[model samples]
Target: MTGREFLEPDSPQQRLYLDGLKRIEIMQKILNELPKADQNLCYQGSYFLAANASLCGLAANHFFRNILHVRKAAIVSALPMAVIPFLSTAAVYDVFVREPLFSGQLNCEVCAVVRGGLVGAVVGGLYPVFLALPLTASLAARYSSSPLPGKENLLRFWLSVSQPVFRKMSWAVLVQVLTGLYLATKHHGIYVKILQQMNTSRDPEELKA
Candidate 1:
């Protein structure tokens, strides 16, 4: 029998199914009304990327100036160095992965989270590399008048600076991965519920078939 024939008009299941359908319709309408550029930006996860990058920047700044006893002036000078790589990474991920996933062009939630995690790892890994640049520059500037004993010495110096930064930023990477996974799983659950509602609201014959 049809959903209306089988389910009482005032039943909770009927209400839930109707509500789910209405929400889906409203979501479609909202998406359709959005400007193309804004839609693209949202689908591409620009907001997520920007927020993550900002947090990472704040964490790095805190580590450098407070924990590591580095100068604020030095951190300010290296801000561009830290920011550019993240922006580039976010742009690439947005174009290739996030847009497709969020636009409903790609339906695999697991794949989306995997891609997000990879992006997060890349960003996390770069933290130390970029963080080292300013420190290395500062060191080189301090000894600019004297020739280094060897290029190996500079390499060692850079490593010394990077290792600690990497250690500190690892936690941020973990948090990013866990957050992405949790969001993906939550969205998947919502999607499954909507599908269940649609199925339950269909004609019994159609459901059986």
Candidate 2:
């Protein structure tokens, strides 16, 4: 009954057309419910979500489920949850941090950029474990293909590196020592500066001191 079915001449094409049309219809309905008075942000967010769905949805089975060997059921719900944190953080920076704290000051501007970038990287690195893996597995099982890449493969790779005596816990202790020293000498100062700017009642003009 969708426009795709009506437009397609062949049976296989008809199914593709109808299914796509139905999804589009549903998305349009949801988008239309957004208030027209301030729709720019809503539209941008909707578009980002729609694009994520297309990339991480059933259509992406070959890349994620088949070749990558991910669980079949996880794709349907993964993208929105994974993307939301990053998108929300970006929005927060744009609307809040940029306007209130930055004010064209060179150091504050640099720190704001660094903080947002670091937050984004941390979110991106953790998203697969926190959000994507669970959602698609739960919501889109029928669309997903199964038999995820077992942790055994990853374990094997780790073992290969860890068998060497140099790869043992000694490296960790050394790195920790170096990190502590670096933080004590440099990172601590930077942290204090950031904290003072964020918390102190000192007027912004006095900050240069």
Candidate 3:
């Protein structure tokens, strides 16, 4: 069935299938038709996102162990650290890469910079609320920093929440903006190499298609 036709169906199953198909369509276009320069940025953005998330997660985990004196099983702590930042990265990446490139606005230097700055501001502003809060709360609770008798929970909450955000927010936003500029400006040397690797690595039959 045509993807468009699939989308018109009211059945939940049809909707789910349509969603998957839409994602596949989008990915194929991105991988195949996007300019080498933009494609490179996407690859770098993904790598940068992973690296940034790892750093933030590690720092948060370190705080729990060193400052709070709470140690968690390696896997238990590592999973959330990996998952949370990647989630935020997905949105930032969309703003930095997909939104501009897909809309054809990224070809112009001024538009790209404007879009990047605006998106970075938004992503940075929300870092504390979205990224920091849950991470802080989780780490704080993991260390069992519950309120003591005669002490308000508010104080503990404020301290845990503020510290991480204050330490990371500016850095994170700067990374986001720099990423946008890099993707928009950097040479496609790495991107070309990555595509060549993918092409060489694909199965013969798949590559033929």
**Candidate that scores best on TM-score:** 1
Winner by TM-score between candidate 3 and candidate 2? 3
TM-score of each: 0.53, 0.30, 0.51
What CA RMSD would candidate 2 show? 21.7
Give the lDDT of residue 49 in candidate 3: 46
Off by over 4 Å in 3: 1-38, 42-44, 105-108, 117-133, 142-157, 168-173, 186-209
Model 2, 113-183: lDDT tens digits are 45443333333223222343344343334554543335768566434423342223233333333322332
Poorest lDDT segment (10 consecutive residues) of candidate 2? 179-188
**Candidate 1, 71-180: lDDT as tens digits:** 43665545654576457656756654555543444567777667656665565334534654565456445646224446758788656655676688778767666654
Model 2 error, position 19 (Å): 58
Q: What are the clashing pairs of model 2?
A: 72-145, 73-136, 73-137, 74-136, 74-137, 75-136
Worst 10 residues of 3 by lDDT: 185-194
Candidate 3 per-residue C-alpha lDDT over 1-209 given as tens digits, one digit per residue, 9 for 90 to 100: 55665466586768777665554444445465557665656555555644565555555555544444445555666666666656665576665655555443345555555555554444433342345345545655766764322256667756764566556555765665665455444423333433454456545335334
lDDT per model vs. reference:
0.55, 0.38, 0.52
lDDT of 2: 0.38
Q: State candidate 1's TM-score.
A: 0.53
| Residue-level lDDT for 14 in candidate 3 | 84
Q: What ranges in model 2 sit over 4 Å off?
A: 1-63, 67-75, 78-87, 102-107, 124-130, 139-144, 148-209
TM-score of 2: 0.30
lDDT order, best first, reads 1, 3, 2
